[model samples]
Target: MWFQNANSPIMEYLLFFHDVTFLLILIIAIAVFFFFELIFMPTDPHRFLIDNQSIEFIWTLTPCIVLLMLAIPSLQLLYLTDEAHGVLKSFKAIGHQWYWSYEWGQELIFDAYMTSIPYRLLDVDNRIKAEMAIPMSVYVSSTDVLHCWTIPVLGVKVDAVPGRLNQIFFSLNRPGIFFGQCSEICGSNHSFMPISLESMV
Candidate 1:
């Protein structure tokens, strides 16, 4: 397979950034390997090894320019991810030892637990629907110990710390089922707590 699938717009941007950075690192690694080979060559005269100001300047300035280019998009994505300007609905998630409970306002609330058998998707007492391109704010907290509320496809990972509330905002780009799991080590049944989001158009 090419890579893990991306569902949301934020995930798409993240995947793009990952690919760009990976290519840049690969190029730098190959160039460094070639430089080392030339340095350790036995028949090398080393005549061009002298300090050249132009070459030094170009090398230094090139990295700065490349970093600036990356920084622009990097910062933009960061702000976009953090922005919850148009959020219409708010949800709350409470993490427990081996299960997760979600509350949507005061109208709906349910607990999610792991299934006994292997399946394509996770099991939840209630499956929340999120509209496409509509921002939603999710507040996460923990009832005991520490847990994490995460959704990989939406690029959301918030720690559920006791007495501390962490919030994250996300919007889905299309209708699909997305899955995640507790990213933190909370307890023995940490592997059982799976998160699933059903995005609807």
Candidate 2:
């Protein structure tokens, strides 16, 4: 699959960008193929065209313009994804050997262990629950080794390094159960350490 279903505003933006980029790539590929066919064909019309300064200038300038077009929105989305403002709640996720421990404020704390039932490795005993459409932040850190807390639908990924906390901010757009796993290669049973989130309205 190219991407999981987008359930957050940031993921929507990312999908839009991906579509535009794919369209641009398709158009460029076709144009290049057409040009190659025209050049190699036995009965070519522009056979005498050895050097065309205008064509060269156009190809160069067109790529520059296309790059600028991609870069502007790319930078804008980068800023938007990195921006964490007006966060209503915050949670701390600590990565252990093969499980995730979440702390909500100082009172509520729980460990999300991979469960065999339900969704198998994708399910967990305890899920991180939060309200939908409300901006929330998560501080991720590791206790033993490196790990990555990633939720594809939410377009949130943060590295969990020992002694260092990496934060990610996102808001769920819909109410459902979203699943993820530790992306980094931590150790044995890395694939078993799954993350699940329950977004509520």
Candidate 3:
């Protein structure tokens, strides 16, 4: 079935191995956790016992084997995905207190500020044309305080730390204006720091 599927060799290996590894580790964890008892028993009944080290071996050995299986292929994939693979462009995004600055280069960059609008408000807002779709690459870092750049659907979120440059890489596989926010609390404007990305193509 894997060979029949049309995808790259590395992608195929990863897809198959990831599941196999997860199942193996999960089974190992279940075996260890259930070994001492059907589920988990406590050294002391007083503790609610949400966590236990009963399956230490299962957890340890399985992860090691999974990593070993993954490492060689992962490294190979990383090497193959290098710059020489294709012509990919880079963008830089800087995070301010309540807005995001995107830079393609010195000549081309834009500042996207979060506007407070109700669900129905989008219907009237012509400026909100990208309410769901604008093709762009977002790179985020901070100007001062710490902030978290999150977009759940794309599975790309990272923190913007001050003084140090923190970067998160993502492309809009889905073209739409996605919602995000500053997860970390910073100053009086923390609650006001709403984030939204307008995906376009």
Candidate 4:
């Protein structure tokens, strides 16, 4: 619920910065594209009010600036992966066709967790926790076709490509269960590739 609970003092600042640097740029870009595509778009109208060359230059430079804003912090975040670690614990999440495999690693204890989604997932009975039991710091990936392991609350998303190990390191800042899914298109049961996390204190 990190996206939903941006009401605190510290998180509000982080959310503001996140929006200024990411969401705003995306909104602006999409609005510009929509404007070009749908709105005030005269019948074969000329761009830049004059020449095609000017319109081309404007579009080119605008995206360059927007993407530069996007990439600068994006690369910074990727390069400095562990700077935000609350503690030193780690977990591993491995992706299969219809479910996710979780490996929880502690200095003293390690447990393997396996779980799947519940029926009527949209209208569940208990919203307090997840149907699966994935522990924190569970590094997750795929075993076959390409998929993506994403936990938005943890601010972590990585591709689950086959034959390759992609890792994400996150400890549970909060003690509860988290849920995610296979964010990439793979096969017939791709939508069933759900992920879960149970944060232990």
Clashes of each: 0, 0, 7, 10
lDDT by residue (170-190, candidate 2, tens digit) is: 999999999999999999889
Error of model 3, residue 143, in angstroms: 2.0
Per-residue alpha-carbon lDDT of candidate 3 for residues 1-201, written as tens digits (9 for 90 to 100): 222231233344445665676786787688667655743555554254346566566567877886787688667755543313222445666668766666776777776664546532121122212212223344567898787875554444568777766544343444555555677787777755555655555
Query: What is the per-residue lDDT of model 1 for residues 56-86, given as tens digits with 9 covering 90 to 100?
Result: 8988998999899789999999998888778
In model 4, pairs of residues that clash are 91-137, 91-138, 91-139, 92-138, 92-139, 93-138, 93-139, 93-140, 95-141, 134-198
Candidate that scores best on lDDT = 2
Question: What is the descending lDDT order?
Answer: 2, 1, 4, 3
Please identify model 2 stretches exceeding 4 Å from their true place: 46-48
Q: TM-scores for all candidates?
A: 0.89, 0.96, 0.53, 0.54
Winner on lDDT between 3 and 4 is: 4
Local distance difference test values of all predictions, in order:
0.84, 0.93, 0.55, 0.56
lDDT of 2 at 58: 84
TM-score (C-alpha, index-matched) for candidate 4: 0.54
In candidate 3, which residue ranges exceed 4 Å CA deviation? 1-25, 38-89, 107-109, 119-139
